[model samples]
Target: MRIVADTGRCVGAGQCVLTAPDIFDQDEDEGTVVLRTAQVSGDALERVRQAVHICPSQALSLCED
Candidate 1:
């Protein structure tokens, strides 16, 4: 799976980071979503999906490739 982060739509709620710190982070200045990795697999896939679901701004999505 591939992570799609729309930083422009991010409100920086930090839910993504809180849910999956290994895959997501927040920009210190803008508080936007910063993706640590665009590709996801294994255990991290579920966490990333949870993060996407919890994102207040709907800035995160996963695409199966």
Candidate 2:
């Protein structure tokens, strides 16, 4: 699985960070989603999804490949 953040829509509210800090981070100066990894463990999928769901700007997307 891959986690992709649509930075164009990212407001960097840090919801993703709160959900999965290992997968997501914010560039405080830029207020953007910083993807820590394109690939993630199956165990982390649900948390990643939660982050995507909680993203106020709908900036996060998970792609299973």
Candidate 3:
């Protein structure tokens, strides 16, 4: 799977970062959701899915690649 982050839709809620620090992070300057990587699998995929669902601004999503 692949992660897709809509940075413009992010509100700096930090939910994604908290949910999956390995896959997501907050930019220091903007505090927006910064994707650590686009591809995900194994244990990381689960956390990424949770992050996408919990993102307050609906800024995160996943797609099959």
Candidate 4:
């Protein structure tokens, strides 16, 4: 799967970072979602999904590659 983070739609709720720090982060200055990597697999997939679901702004999406 591929992870997509839309900074334009991000509200800096930080739920993504809190749920999956390995795959997501926050920009220090803007407080926007920063994607550590777009690629995801294995055990990390579930975590990434949780992050996507918890995103209040619905800025995160997972696409099948």
lDDT agreement with native, every candidate: 0.92, 0.86, 0.90, 0.93
Clashing pairs in 4: none
Instruction: Encode model 2's per-residue lDDT on 1-65: one tens digit a residue.
Output: 88888999998788998999898888878979898888987778889988888889998887878
Best candidate, lDDT: 4
Candidate 1 error regions (>4 Å) = none
**Clash pairs, model 2 backbone:** none
Off by over 4 Å in 3: none
TM-scores, each model vs. reference: 0.95, 0.90, 0.95, 0.95
In terms of lDDT, the poorest run of 10 residues in model 2 is: 35-44
Residue lDDT tens for model 4, 1-65: 99998999999999998898888999999999998999999999999999988889999999999
Error of 3 at 2 (Å): 0.7
User: lDDT tens string, model 3, 1-65?
Assistant: 99989989999999998888988888999999888889999999999988888888999889998
What's the number of clashes in each of the models? Answer: 0, 0, 0, 0
Candidate 4 or 2, higher TM-score: 4
